[model samples]
Target chain A: MSDQPTPTFISLDDAAAMTEGTRVTFIPGLQALYSEALKNVCFVKGISLTRALHPPMGIDKETGEDRQARLFELTSQTSLPTMFHDDERPRNVWIEQLALAERVGSPSAPALIPDDVAQRVEMFGLCAVILGEDGMVWNMRIMNDGPLSRKYGYNKTASAAAPAKVAEVIALIDARLKTQAENGSAYLVGDAVSAADIYWATMSMCVTATPPDIMPVTAQNQGMLKFFASNAKVPAIAEVLTPRIEEHQHYILKTYCETPAVLGGDPL
Target chain B: MSDQPTPTFISLDDAAAMTEGTRVTFIPGLQALYSEALKNVCFVKGISLTRALHPPMGIDKETGEDRQARLFELTSQTSLPTMFHDDERPRNVWIEQLALAERVGSPSAPALIPDDVAQRVEMFGLCAVILGEDGMVWNMRIMNDGPLSRKYGYNKTASAAAPAKVAEVIALIDARLKTQAENGSAYLVGDAVSAADIYWATMSMCVTATPPDIMPVTAQNQGMLKFFASNAKVPAIAEVLTPRIEEHQHYILKTYCETPAVLGGDPL
Candidate 1:
């Protein structure tokens, strides 16, 4: 388990007082790839966090207002993983968080982004493939939504493109692994672990779909997890994911994400 | 210019006759990124092509039939750049075409895919980012549609995400260039020009719109090009296109795309 203090999470209603000096994030998806990734990054860097619940479906229980709408009002986006720090500007998006991990992290918990210019470029490029709109998670979401649409709701034509897009991304990650293997280093960019590694390690769960033991999601969210897991289980896409990636996943969980990522918490 | 013969294109009706021995592609957008890139690949490899027009708007003027529907009947897809060859399965998508370019290309022309496994994987991965549904062109299209929705017609929410997605893709290409600069190579993947180079050189026109003299489009298509250029012109994405990418563009165009890409061609 990471030596960092267990993060104190607050209800959205209680977030006002905590926002004064604390680092806060409006987060959702008790078991989301992006959400878990963000929490893991905080744990690795030993950055204490105050989490404000942005419910998975965007609806908050107390306010009955769409948390996504609230997020958009504050951060101009509905996406999760928005970090608000004291005094300085709010950091949104996965890339910004990676950079923040570097800024706030001590020497012992070094930044995931590499120092080499080329590696940095590679890291950013890889992250874009995973985090960008047409990226792995986005494709995975579409795949999840497509099936769910029949049972719940979706745009069939648009969602039809998800599998191929997801396949393309997984192939890219596999290729990166091949290159890393040739270089005799297991990491994506260079010899050391970088943001690319962290992002992929967590985001890849969109495909591999780990059990609840490590990434603990509530029973309420189990259906959503199945959606993600089934999306990843597509044969063509799943085949592209070599054992090399699973090795990285194991390494990441063992090293940085050993602490169980349980759902829900009390106010600070 | 590539030493290959100037290809003779045909209408959808004429495509049936040439299906026996000739390599054919269901193509649209006279100066379209995918269409032109495919043509350039064939030209470089001395592979003669029989082109069948897939009307950009998906409606055929001559028969008043939905061309996309017609394409789907042939290949189960409406996307352009689908290639039909003699006695083999149809090749669709950019990845398939890249693989085919190697099989059909001559010793003199050579495949655009790199020989190095790592480079090949990178090339495929990068190409996926371009050709995949969420790649640059897809994002550009959405951004174009979003603004055009007020003036023309489009899906607004989908289009809103375009600029950022396009920016992410452009950033990746720029990062590749930076890494190439370090290795003393200008190409996106390896030392030699690969399919990745050709695809970007042409597809990027969707962003950095080339002048009419080189990539001549119909007056009707001019608006589309403008939409793409303006989308690329967004500061976040435009700033990523460094001098290195420009150098490669110049190299690809001077070497492979010297002939003006006029808007339409006569049927053979």
Candidate 2:
């Protein structure tokens, strides 16, 4: 396992007790790609956050539900990676979350969004490919959980088309990475690290297995992850997981992210 | 049929000739919900837009493809309702389009976003229920186009669940509307009209057919729309199309949105 130090995590009760600072609720595991990406954004930007577990991580055993109903009262939805900054309305959408991070980040830190309009558009577009509905991770979910799992309920025709759709997305990522590598740029969008880079680095876990050393997980989770990875490795999908793409994922993770993931679970 | 005057529409060729100011590409048909919503937002904000037809409207009969190809080149995708503001990058996503309207809207125009943080959150949440993924229109699409029509490829399980999913969303909308009406607020979220109100007003077309006078469509399109409406009126769906929801939609259309939709097409 990597020697990276584990980041501190506060319980929901502890996080809720703080009435004055920023608090975030996220799924506390490696497989929670959005959570990991949001956490990385905060880390890179040097934004202080009180992290608390959500859903399964914080479920009430007796009721088999979220321990806290207050989250629902606050955001009116059960989705995670939601942030509450002071008394501001809870930021639930990914784009909103990124905007919030950009706003609250330390002034000394590098900006996650490109200042140039063209580059900013390009960055948001690439991030959408990684995080938007029907993007790469979405297809990956279809492969692992079936299309209906998320309530999308596409027809058998679309269900059958998942592999091709995923293959197309992977090819797009591979082509982008190849071009960026040729230009000698380490980041996805422009000269500096952006939300696109961080998103891909974390979201890649859905397709390719992260080394246990880089992102240690519970043994049970590791097995579950392997199942998901295997389910996602259809022939078309396998063809597009190019070396350049994998290299970029690893590069971004090791260089920019918190290794060992700060996930408080036991190592596989 | 509608005593309401038809709005003027510029052809794509005409719109493209103008070299200055703001331009937008949108589908030129009654059934395009997002297009109608975006157009309404601009109309209410008093933002002048050079409207150009997209996709099937501008498709070449010989090749049966988009005549301009420039739209795909500009946005990297074929989806419509994209806006280009004074040499800025094209805004394609719904949220981005709304943000653009907010930015360029008349100085004295009422804000589409509520000034109160809680109301803003509530507004967005309601808007999400109407337009977000797995929201009302999405379910309407499933009812009309089948699950496989889009790239989402859900299984039979989800396909089977669409009616219930749609019913739940409708109930949620009905509940929200009922509460707002009880509070004597004409709008969905706050004291004044907001994006959420306009979004629901336009998006409601998917479930309920608009009067022919107000949104006159070609006879062929009228038949097609009837089919869509019929398909969407499954038992569970019909139960939630409460009278309050219908009245609210008509009220918003007549009071705020441009009558006859400025859709340059022929009357039914």
Q: In order, how many clashes per candidate? A: 5, 5
What is candidate 1's CAPRI-style docking category based on DockQ?
incorrect
lDDT tens digits, residue span B1-268, model 2: 3343444566655554566667777654454777778889998888987777765535688887766465544453345576767655566667767767876899888788664433554565566556655556666666534423353334556567777776776677678788888998888777799988899888877777677655676643676578657855678878878888889888888888887666645554
Residue A49 displacement (Å), model 2: 2.3
**In candidate 1, which residue pairs get closer than 3 Å at backbone N, Cα or C atoms, i.e. clash?**
A112-A194, A112-A195, A149-A153, B112-B194, B112-B195
Residues A1-268, model 1: lDDT tens digits: 2222344567544553344543545443345567667777777777776777653444678988875665444543445665665544455556556656666766788667554434554666677667754456766676645432332223576478777767777777777788888989877778877777777888887777776555655544566667667866788787787787778776777676654565553211
lDDT of 1 by residue, B7-104 (tens): 45676545633546445454443465676788777777777667776534446789888756655545434456667666444555565565566667
Candidate 2, A232: how far from true, in Å? 5.7
Each candidate's fnat: 0.00, 0.00
Give the alpha-carbon lDDT of every model: 0.63, 0.68
- Candidate 1 chain B, run of 10 with poorest lDDT: B145-154
In model 2, the runs with Cα more than 4 Å from the true position are A1-17, A57-61, A64-69, A146-148, A152-155, B1-268
* DockQ values, each candidate: 0.02, 0.02
